[model samples]
Each structure stands twice: as C-alpha cells, then as structure tokens.
Target chain A: METKIKEIIKQVKKGDQSAFEDVVTFYQNKVYQICFRVIGNAHEAEDLAQETFIRAYVNIHSFDDKRKFSTWLYRIATNISIDRIRKKKPDYFLDAEVKGTDGLDMYSQLPAEQLLPEEEVESLELQSYIQQEIMQLPTKYRSVIALRFVDELSLAEISEILSIPVGTVKTRIHRGREALRKRLRRV
Target chain B: MSCNKQFINLMHKYLDGELTRTDENLLRSHLHSCQSCQKHFHELKRTTTLLKSSSELQPSSNFTEKVMASLPKEKKRVGYMRWFKAHPVITAAAIFFIFMFSSVFSAWDQDSQLSVSKDKNLIIQEDTVIVPEGVTVDGDLVVKNGNLKIDGSVNGNVVIINGEHLMASAGEISGEIEQVNQVFEWMWYHIKDITKNLFAFTNK
Candidate 1:
C-alpha cells in the first residue's frame, strides 16, 4: 500500500491527471463519509468532497511522501469542513439545510422514498431525530461522534487525521456518545 | 483505568464494534456488576444502533459525473513534445518576448553607437543618430563655418569637427573645453599644396 501510494504521488508529480483520478476514486467514499458526518447533509457533503479533491489536485506538490495519504486527505477535508461551519453558523448546529446554488433546499433531495416504504418512513423520521439529537452535542463532542461513528474512522485514525492525541480521541468519543445518548432519550 | 471510565470508553468501542473479544468480555463483566455503567452502556448502544440503522444516504449515481462535469475540462495538458510543436498562445508570448528583447538591446546599442560617432570627426548628417541623455563624450567640438550649441549637457571632453554643436549652459564638459578655429590651418594648407603638386608631377 505504501509503495502504491508513493507511485501514485510520483505519477501526480509527473502531471498524470488520470493518476489523480485514481487517487480520487480510492478515497472518495471515505472523504464523502467524513464530509457528510461533519456537515450532516448529503448535498453539502458532496460539494465539500468535490472541493476537497480540487484542492488536493491543485496542491498535490505539497504532499509529503513520509506522511500517510489518507491522513493528508482528511486534513484537507477537515479544514474545509471547519471553514464551512465557520461561515454558515447555523442556529441548530451545522444541520440546517441552506439553499444551494440553484436556489433549491439542499437536503430536500435525500433518499426518503427509495427505502422500502415502511423503512423509508422510519428512516426519514430517524434521520431528522438523529440530526436534532446530534446537534445538541457540544461541538467538540459532536465532531468526535461525526468523525468516529458516522465516518467509521478508527480512534487512532481520527487522532492522526485531526492531529489530536489518541487519549483525547477516546475521551471525546466516550463523552460524545454519552451526550448523544442523553439527547436521544430526551427525544 | 478504573472500571467507570473504562466502561464508558469500552462502551463506545463496543457500540462501534471495535472492541476485541477480551475487552468486550471485561466490559461486559464490569457492566453486569455496575448498574450505572450498565444503564449508560445500554442506552449508548441503543442510540448508536439507531444512527447506524438510519438511512444510509449515498449521493446520486451521477454524483461523480456531476462533480467531473462541474470541474473545468482537464485542460488537455501539452506535454513537452507537443508544447514545442506550436501552440498559438505560446507562440504569441514567445514572439512578444523576442520583439521586446531585440528592441531593448537595439536601443542600448544605438545609444552607445551615437555617443562614439559624436566623438569622431564624422558629422551626423541625418537625424538617425540617437544619443541617449546623461552619456559623456570626450573630444573636440568644431562646427566649421556652421552652428555650435549643446542641446542638454556634456560631462566629459566635447570634440566636434565641422558642423553645429549645441551646448546648453547646463552642459558641462569636465575635460578642457577647447574650440579650435580650424577654418584653414597650416597643416591643412601644407597637405593640400603637396597633394596638388603630387597630382601635377604624376600628370608629367
């Protein structure tokens, strides 16, 4: 895996755009997952993911070979997500669906009807409920929950990706989950 | 770690299915005995289960294509080989730089040439001579039976022969400013007479 990443980096340096596409394909799902969890919306997550790739493409030369590619990607995504939050400053955490470029509500395109009708109904209900409850979490805990559980990144991976201590990751995850449980019970 | 904090951290790991068998067993043993941790662990599990079972929203199938479409075209990068083969924009820029370089050097060359020619007894018959300002010329200035005035300034020796030379009061020749009147000198008369006699002798 290390050898392959190095080769991809080399190809990127050689101006091989296709090699960059391969890097995008390999990390897209993980990147999208992180974006979605951080922002808690599909459309914004997709936009952020696209922007992340574009940023990576423009700045590929700065990538350090000694570091993990995944870590570098997450760092880019995390910074972008943080910037979005700082800009939006929604009332109820980052879950508010602002109008998109086309002037249509971004979250309105969710897959509410695609799931088996009964599950679809339940899923929509649960999604909204989860969003509200997750929003109630302290931002730090909220971030941990989003990065760890929603994104499915390992505690160690989250620590490395966020540049926080491993102990901090574990503590945040625990506290975040605890706070989330309280929010859900209240609902 | 104490069973209290260990229970909470392990509960998070267990909910995420990241706990190993040994840790899971230890956590379960602790939870069974500790009612508070047990209650917290159970509730944490239930809520996380709810989140996991929540709608797994993948972006539209066209998502990647849409992103690709939103991006500007890949900009068919010209490889080194093709870059040299002739691109209109590149060619234009190259031509512009060449013109600029030549003009800059030509202007410098012309200025130097004009200063040198001014010192020589050669008169600039045409307005083609371009003497850039602030340059010094060291020689004599003799505009024989013509005008003589320095346009701007002269710092070094100013020697001119036969033509008008303008030295604005601002013009200061650091070297001696000597304007010898050479309407007809002894050397010129002797040389002319000898040349005329030589022609007569050659005819004989």
Candidate 2:
C-alpha cells in the first residue's frame, strides 16, 4: 500500500496534479491531527494541514524515496508548525490557521449527557486537568506530550518529526508524562 | 510488589502492550497488592479510553470544497521547468555558480593563451638570445639585437634589446615588460633595464 503511495509520490513530483491530490487525500487527516496536536487548535490545524501539502508540493522533487512518505510529510508539518510558533506569540493552537467563531476552545463546556459516567467523569476531569497542567509545561515537554499521545505517532516517527534521536524522543515522552503525573498529583 | 518505581515503568509498557509475560506477571502481582498502582493504572486506562472516545473535529461539510476552491484550477500536468526557473533565488544561485566557473576558466585560458603567445614570439626571434630549457622568465620575453635562447624555463622577464631570442620546450616567462628593436635615444632604457633585471634576479 505504501509502495503504491511512493509511486504516486514520484508521479506527483513529475507535476501530476491528480497524483498530488491523491497525496493530499491520503495524508490530510494525519497531517491535520499532527498540526492540531502541535498547535493545539483546529482552525490552525486545518490551515497548517493545507500548508503542509502545499509545501510538500513545492519540495516534492527533493523528497528521497528511501524514507517513508508519512515520515517525510510529518517532518514537513512539524517543522512548519515549529517555525510558525517561533515567529509568532500564539494565544491558541498553532494549527488554527483559520479564524472561525464556531471553533471549540479547550475550555468550552461539555454537554451533560456527553460527559463520562460519574466515576469515569472524575477520570475524564483528571485527564482534562492533566491536559491543563500540560499546557503550563515548557514547550519541550508540551511538544513531546502532544506528539506522543495526541498524534499517537511512534517514538521513531516523533524523533523524525522533531529531528531528534529516538532515545531523546523516548526520554522526552517519559519525562513529559512524569511531569504531567506529578502535576496531576498537586491538583 | 507495589507501586514502586519498577512497577511504574512496567505500567508504561503494559499500557502499550509491550510488557513480556514475566514483567506482566510481576506488574499483575504488584497491582493485586498495591492500591496506589491500581488506581494509577485505572487512571491511565480511563484517560486513554476518554481520549479515544473524544469526538474528532472534521473539517466543515464543504471542507473539501473549500480546499479545492483555494487551489488553482486543476490541471493534469504542470510545467515544472518553468516553475523551477521562475524561482528567483534558485535561478540566482545557478547563475552565480555559472558566472564563477566561467570567470575561473577565463582566467586560466587567458593565462595559458598569454604564455602560448609569448612562447611563439620567443621561437620567432631565435637568433639573438639563447634561453636554456627548464628556465622560466618571470616577466616579459623580448628579443632585439641581443640573442636570448632558452633550453630551460625562465622565471622572470626576458627582453632582448636589438637581439634574437629562443625559448626551448621547457622555457616559460610569466610577467610583463617591453621588447623593442629600435633604440630610440631616451633616459629611461637604462632605468627600466636595471629594474627588470633586479626583479628577474630576485625571482630566480
């Protein structure tokens, strides 16, 4: 399946618009999720997602076939978000490129019925609490946490995205979670 | 068999289904006895479940429409060559590299041509100066009444005032000076000769 995508990518690099669209359709959701996790917003994620595909289009010729297409795409998205964050002081998710009034904020109230069962609600509350605590973490920890959990990418994939070694990725995820658990304890 | 650090580590892998049987049994034994670890495990389980159950945000119903709208009119193929050439930075870099290469080669060709011309002039007036091979004249080679023949290369200028000059196969002159046959009476000839000889001797 991936080999087929690889072939499609080669065709896309040859200036095939249909192939490019295929690439976009294949990776849009994953790219959006990554942008959302990194930027912490939906609108930005959507915009960044589109931007990632545009960038991939621009630099497709430079894409080496030895690496996984997904890995390459993730690297592009991660870098774009990181660069955007460094240049701008963002109040919301970096992925939120689009400014929409209807978009949900992290603090928006959940409907009563939609809430977890009483015991589970406490856990959900604790998870949300943990997320809030995570937001207070340094960018390094926050990035690792979001990549590890929210994006659900492998440690190796996260390492590639961050341009760090796998060991560093592992350590970051470990320490980031530990920090979250510690913060949760305080609450 | 409690919520010790080891069990904590095990829980991380356990949640990911990475624990071996022995490690799994160890964690299970620890969990059975330890309330805190059990609670922590439950919390982890709950969190992951909640995360999974959380509603995902899809792009708007017209999301694909919006995306397609933002894109240019769909074409089956694009002229990549024109696109690549239109990139000012890349084009500038390429032009810069080409200019540098041409400049370097031009210098080399000029130097080689200059040497070839000088060597030819040395052969043309071979009656006056005998320049030995393997000697290089560092400056100009000029033959007038005096003969200059080279079996070796010269490292300095070669000038024959009213003489013939011969540059053998190994002879080379790299610098510049004047070659004149008609001795127009002037106060400058002696001074120029002194300066040229001084420079030539120093180079040797």
Note the Cα lDDT for every prediction shown: 0.63, 0.61
Q: What is candidate 2's lDDT per residue for A86-162, written digit by digit as tens? A: 77765545323234632223323333123346534454454344444555444555566666665577887788778
Candidate 1 off by > 4 Å: A1-6, A90-123, A185-187, B1-6, B9-26, B34-36, B49-55, B72-204
Alpha-carbon runs more than 4 Å astray in model 2: A90-134, A179-187, B52-55, B65-204
Q: What digit string (tens of lDDT, one per residue) describes model 1 on residues B1-204? A: 235576777877886567899999998788788888877877887877766553365656666665555544445553553465657788778887688556644543443222333533233434222223554444433233334445344555544433334444355556644442343442353345467789999999
Predictions' DockQ, in order: 0.30, 0.17
Query: How accurate locally is residue B191 in candidate 2, as Cα lDDT from 0 to 100?
Result: 48
lDDT of 2: 0.61
Residue B120 lDDT, candidate 2, scale 0-100: 44
Docking class of 2: incorrect
